[model samples]
Target: MTVKDLATLTPSGYPAVSLLMPTHRTPPDNQQDPIRLRNLLTETRRRLEADESVPADVAAAVYDEIAEAAAHVDLRQVGEGLALFASPGQVHVRLLETPVHERVVVADTYEIRDVVADAARRHRYWALVLSEQPTRLWSGDGSTLVEVTTHGFPFTHEGPGGTQGLPRDYGQNPSAHRDERHRQFFRDIVTGLTQVDALDTRPVFVLGVERYLAFFSAEWTAAIAGTVPGNYDHSGPHDLHRILAPHLAAYQAFEQIAALEHLDVARGANRYAAGLPEVWQLARQGRGAHLLVEEDYHSAAWIHDDHLHPAEQQPTSAPAGTLVDDAVDDVVELVARQGGDVTFVGDGSLATDGRVALILRY
Candidate 1:
């Protein structure tokens, strides 16, 4: 998805990201160092949570430092967090710990299916169901059929004279039926889409045949066009957890980016467009969670009060501003200090020209 779409998909109100790092602690060879290693982990978690913007590089550096400090400790085994991605809509949960040499073993092959089913049960919203069957019916809280169609042979056979015997009956094969079933499946989907369009929540996940996905895309593009804001995944089979995981991760990222971008845009409005008193008024009313400003006008001030008392009281060395400039800077700083996100846009860019929008009323 485009970065602009990412901004729009973010949920409006949230605080403090839930960072899940399910890792296997390798016990140090020296029995005496267990406490020390545990302390190191605790410190790492604290450091990560304390930062405002902790990028990947900063995390790596912090990890390296901690590892070096614990050199004397003999940590043998490492476990990877199987789910390391962010959620789709509201919460942006990231998996920090990476897997090492050992591969994660799923005791039962059907375990993935069970996980997906459980998630569907928990969140009854837009459940994107996926499957490998033709004309298979999914009857969950909000279920839809997905007919996967692939143009490939299911199996191969050999003839008596060292010649390959091709299956002449295409319609009888499960794969061949997928296409036909999928075409029929869209009728049900379009009905659901009509109902879903009127609702306020996100659309349910539907995983199924490749043909189903193709039909869904075309229908959505033609039917809703610019109205739908969120991104969806139609890839792979519907084993509850696997299908839902990536969407969940993406949802989480969208929210985080939205909150941050919104704050930036609000800050921009307060600074560069001081003539627009409505912008500052919105900020005061807590409606200014996000702001969009031109990237070139990064130096604009965010003023809050109409009077220039703050700038006037500054010493001679401080930068002087006209009454207008002071008023703008006051609003910009006010928004920034109050935890709003501001996004700087380049000139002629969508964001600079009002194409880059924010969700204030949501």
Candidate 2:
């Protein structure tokens, strides 16, 4: 599910559960995942039975939802991971494009501590390689691009098309018969676009020769991300990625720069905070407006005496409060739950100050 979708869920009362686990679609690992999940469900069931505070009916209802969720999981369709959230009446199962850590929580509210990822939050754009013969559609997240399918636009010849085959008097008038045929070819592409789902909402980058690209501007239905000039008729995924990377990167990089600018303005106004401890505090208080975290940044820390303490400095015995796997993850969950935004910037972007920075809601 998208972060925005998760944000719309209003918290219900006790026994709200979040289950995060790694699942495999291939052999050996795939064989073990279901077994692991079954074990976790058994443990959760036992814990629910042992809790005398919960009414029998309520516990049963919660267990039924969890069990139902488990029943829906298909080993054959599994991805690298699974994220399951179950409240009393609500259940959400999101199959991630990337793997997340195996963790489970049975708490007063859903545990979304690890739900946010760059792939999950980033704008998914499609690269359309338009040609008269084999129009193609690709899905990308600014890094990896994959061709999903190909369609045929209106054209008779099998080889790559150009104006060479057009009739001699084609350019005589704007409304000439051959000119209308070319426009009809572009119109067919628009029809193909509508048939494929979600092409209208997501931004699309078009790659084609100058003439086709020029015509597609008026005929295309989707919001165009950008156009790269070339006929990528024989280009493979790697070639397409090489051509599209700089454009997508240049567009996506704006987020980090915008975040840094906001930080500077907020800092000058005494509305900004840096460092894990301060940011974590703001997150807990629901004061986060925007969070800027360095990519792959993590710190082992836990709460102690209502304050955050790095795991290393704490006593060997269990800490007094929550033991978080990573404080960064905790902040992400908190800020997102509060309807704030999170940005994962490149390393060294926040290195001079702190690995994490936040702008306050106040």
Candidate 3:
């Protein structure tokens, strides 16, 4: 699913089901995916049947929808994880580029905290390759970059310096005319980008030779990650990915360092929370500006009087207060939904601070 889906998805009816699991991309390991899916389907049926709240028809329909969605999964192209969200009228099957905690939830709302967290922490960007023949756009997740071939991509230059040559009437200024035509072509590419919903809010990396890059820079004035001088028109996804991977790695490293600096400044200004409970409270009250979480930290807790109480295990049924299967995930969802920054830092980066931290807006 896309970042837009995180906000747009809703339960068409109650008793929505979310199934999530880590998946393998290749080899003998991926063969177990079907078996694992069948087992989860069985678990889902059990949970729905056991629940007295959900009506029989609704339960059966949701299960069937999920099953249908599962049957269509292209195991050959499966990524690191798979997520299925289904209701009586809604269904979305997502192949996650990163692994998420394996879990299922049946509730009135879709389980999207994991998706939100991934979108918040994992970088998504566009790699725009410029050329006279045909420009291309690629969408990148944390680990993979896939070509975007619809609507705004594979833009071929068709005027002036392209297939058509300059008229003899403008021979003295033919170079200038050619440059302007290329600029206009690049402008069309930018306009085309507007039609692509998946390209929203993603930083761009424009790659081309010096002149083409200059024309593009002159036309598009948005969040460009960087410019790489290259001829990627002939390069396939694998070749382009090999060229772009190191750049993304460096960007991620820079982002982590920048976030740590933000936290330090917040702590110095007395606008930081050091642990989960305090962060949760601040986040609930909308005080969170930036949430910094350890990559491996997860906790299950109970909410009592709006405060979190540590739970020995994730509660199946809440007999005491309200059970939170994963408070860390909840907190991440809370901060991100309110337009706050969320970063999953390396483990032990905040060990003394209980493996979690928050930079408050105040």
Candidate 4:
């Protein structure tokens, strides 16, 4: 399933169970996935039964839904990881390439923002390869590129040639004439893209040789601003992936820089928050406009009465009843449920010891 599918889920005021775990894409790993899933379901059942506050009927309903979800897991459809969400009368399982830590969360809402952000990073853009021959279009995440057909394109390159109903041949000034044609060609491409139902709001990255790229860049539209200067016209999908890595990396870096700029602006305006405690408070109150968490940062913590109790280390002496998992995961979920944005950034992006920061809506 897509991230959009995950985002549209509305809480039903009933218990929502979220299960995330590493699953196998291939054998050995794949072989053990069923066992892992079974184990998770067992844990989920135990948690539901142990929660004395949950109504028996509601707990049973949720558990049965979880079982139904587990029953449909096709090994062939599994990916490197798996995420399952279950609530009364609803269940969704998404296969993902990014591995998530093994965790089970039972709450009133689903913890899905991290997965949504991951999906965006991997598969949010369309790659348009501009060529004199067959102009190609691809839907891609950072890791994979799937070619998509654009009907009636490579317009001039195809049908007719020469003057009358034929391709034009600029005599001596072929270079200048061709340049102007390319300019107009790119303009038309921009217009076409705007009307394309498939393109939507996803960013477009144009790939072509230096000359064509220069021409396209001059007439660049906001819809298609990213241009990669290269010649990969004959490359297949695998080769295209390799070609795209550097460009995608550069794009993500640019996004990170922009996020930092926004954070700086928010801080200057006194509309920002830092560290876990403050960010958590804002998140609980739905005051978070944007949450920026350091990538690979996780703290064991749990919420009680809307307060975040964070533990720096797995304390030798712990509270009797505390839900300690990745606190950042809860932060992401809270921001997402409030319709706020969440961004996972590089280690030092926040420049704070807490490794969590927020841009407040107020």
- TM-score each candidate: 0.29, 0.67, 0.85, 0.70
RMSD of 3: 3.6
lDDT of 2 at 53: 80
Question: Counting only residues 3 or more apart in sequence or on different chains, how many pairs clash (N, Cα, C under 3 Å) in candidate 4?
Answer: 7
| Model 4, span 61-176: residue lDDT tens | 98898788778878666566788888877877766776788889999888786577456335467777887666777777556566765644444443232122333455546556
Residue 287's lDDT in candidate 2: 95
Between prediction 2 and prediction 3, the one with superior TM-score is 3
Name the TM-score of candidate 3. 0.85
Candidate 1, residues 173-234: lDDT per residue as tens digits? Answer: 74445444444455455555445434423434445445446656665543221112223233
User: In order, what is each prediction's RMSD in angstroms?
Assistant: 16.8, 6.3, 3.6, 6.1
TM-score ranking from best candidate downward: 3, 4, 2, 1
List clashing residue pairs in candidate 4: 122-141, 122-142, 123-141, 161-166, 161-167, 162-166, 162-167
lDDT of each: 0.36, 0.74, 0.81, 0.72
Better of 1 and 2 by lDDT: 2
lDDT by residue (48-138, candidate 2, tens digit) is: 7778887888878887888798889886776677877776777777666556777767787776655565233455677888776666777
Q: Which candidate is the best by TM-score?
A: 3
Weakest ten-residue segment in model 2 by summed lDDT = 153-162
Q: In model 2, which runs have C-alpha deviations exceeding 4 angstroms?
A: 10-15, 24-30, 44-80, 97-101, 117-123, 126-204, 207-212, 216-224, 228-250, 265-271, 315-319
Candidate 1 vs. true structure, TM-score:
0.29
Full candidate order by lDDT, most accurate first = 3, 2, 4, 1
Candidate 1 vs candidate 4: the TM-score winner is 4
